[model samples]
Target: VGMGDSCAPSNNLPYGTAMEANLIQQLTLRGWAVVVTDYEGLGTPGVHTYTVGPSAGRAVLDAARAATRLPEAGLSADTPVGIMGYSQGGQAGSWAAELQGSYAPELKVKGTATGGVPADLLKVADFNNGSYGAGLVFMAAAGQDAAFPELR
Candidate 1:
């Protein structure tokens, strides 16, 4: 939710926090299958690639791919996939859906829904520069640097 490996969803006891746990519980209660990704470097090695589109998006789609391939899950390519998220997750989900046509054409994406996406990074940075959320800008910058080491 914030920065660092400690905050990674995978490292959390109930999937990042109470809110995330509750969301997963709600979906599972309705018999809807859900899979959450920790994204690259999160809880694994190196700094998390926080808001970078391609890395997060590829992780989302790849999660779907991994879920459907699970032998015990019984899910298949025929299963309809739906992506949903808010804020950072929203960005990831939307990117996955956008890239699905080429990156994961085989996934049967039924639909996608997102909210509070930081689509315009410059605007978000400007708006939060002097506010309580200002730290987010620095975190995002570090994430960008992590995602594109060559560019840096």
Candidate 2:
């Protein structure tokens, strides 16, 4: 499956509202069933951790596992799953791939494709010269701090 920007799965809006509808349509035409997740907390509670890779990855992978149980997916647990994303979605995809070995080993993740990945928030901040993107970098830091207090 593939994820678009933050508006894609992490927010249950229309394809046009989230990402390019044509892209989803084309992927579907290519015999790929796409499943999107609105992350853990979007319109619910707490804050939207923009580039929190681990949280993003867990949401995507768990959503995939949940999809297997849905009649529309028509997939079994043994099915080889692949994840791909760009931008914020890329961070999520990368997290999912990195965590799969220990987090969801039963999912059978075949591979992952991530583009425009923000692997290092500090680096991204430095590259962007601490602009609005730097705020996102800050959000990532908060997420990491929350996920791992020891790292703080």
Candidate 3:
């Protein structure tokens, strides 16, 4: 399954970013069914959780759980699962990797591929300040605050 990037709320899954469409099509062509998430709040009411690692990771793993339970999806507990994402989504994928062993031990996750992962958010903040990636840093901060209101 693919974890979609950060995006504005949109209840319609088909209207997701082009990247989501491409991933779904490519995976389907290769004989693999796909599932994706709009994260905690995007495409729903309230603020998105954004970069909160545990929240995002849980959403990804939960999607896999929900998918396996769907009989029409032809997925089983034994079916192999792979997680892929980029940028903000990459950080989420990384969290899922760390969380899978304990949070979703039943899942047969074979692998994970993440690109442009913000391995260290503080580092990202320091580097992106006054740079082109500043917007991303701001979003991350806001997301954290929303998830953990004490931070605000």
Candidate 4:
């Protein structure tokens, strides 16, 4: 249910394409409160760095903080939280978990689940050399550029 750069929780797109609606439905079905984030720059004016993990993590965590303050959510300061993501989102989720120890320690991030993590971009580029999946090389380049501007 993790959204990419061009998508946002507030976008009026179809349910399948919007993480907000999907998360809402799932939370309702399970009787849980859902908190959705538009990431750092998706709905705001700025570059939407798709795979910049720290920015993504901060956006997610800050959105949760904002959600907890809403009267409709009825969430308390002591509520437990967990993180999960896939692909680019896996990077963001991992960053969120790592930051939780220092930056939002009260949020109680019990665990995290990530899949298809691009932990080593250089290796990925070598693996996809000269193939159609070589497009991933470009993606890695963009991600690295956003994550480490000095590398750009």
- What RMSD does model 2 have? 4.1
Model 3, 32-128: lDDT tens per residue? 9688777876655567777788988998899899999899999999989999989867988989999999999999999999998978889989999
lDDT (tens digit, per residue) of candidate 4 on 81-127: 77777766677788888888778777867789888876776787798
List of clashing residue pairs for candidate 4: none
TM-score-wise, the better of 1 and 2 is: 1
Candidate 4's displacement at residue 147, Å, is 5.2
Regions more than 4 Å wrong, model 1: 13-18
Q: Candidate 2, TM-score vs. the true structure?
A: 0.77
Please write out the lDDT profile of model 2 over residues 24-133, one tens digit for every residue: 77888998777766664444354554567788889889988897778767888888788988877788889999998888888978888889887887778787765655
Question: Rank by TM-score, descending?
Answer: 1, 3, 2, 4
For all candidates in order, the CA lDDT equals: 0.88, 0.71, 0.80, 0.69
Q: The CA-based lDDT of model 4 is what? A: 0.69
Report the lDDT tens digits of candidate 1 across residue range 1-152.
67777777777846446358888888989999999888887876888888898888999999999999998888987899999989989999989988999999999999999999999999999999999999999989999999888987
Stretches of candidate 3 above 4 Å error?
1-13
Q: Cα lDDT of model 2 overall? A: 0.71
Over 4 Å off, model 2: 1-12, 130-135, 138-152
Whose TM-score is greatest here? 1
Model 3 lDDT on a 0 to 1 scale: 0.80
Query: What TM-score against the true fold does each predicted structure earn?
Result: 0.94, 0.77, 0.87, 0.76
Model 3 quality (TM-score)? 0.87
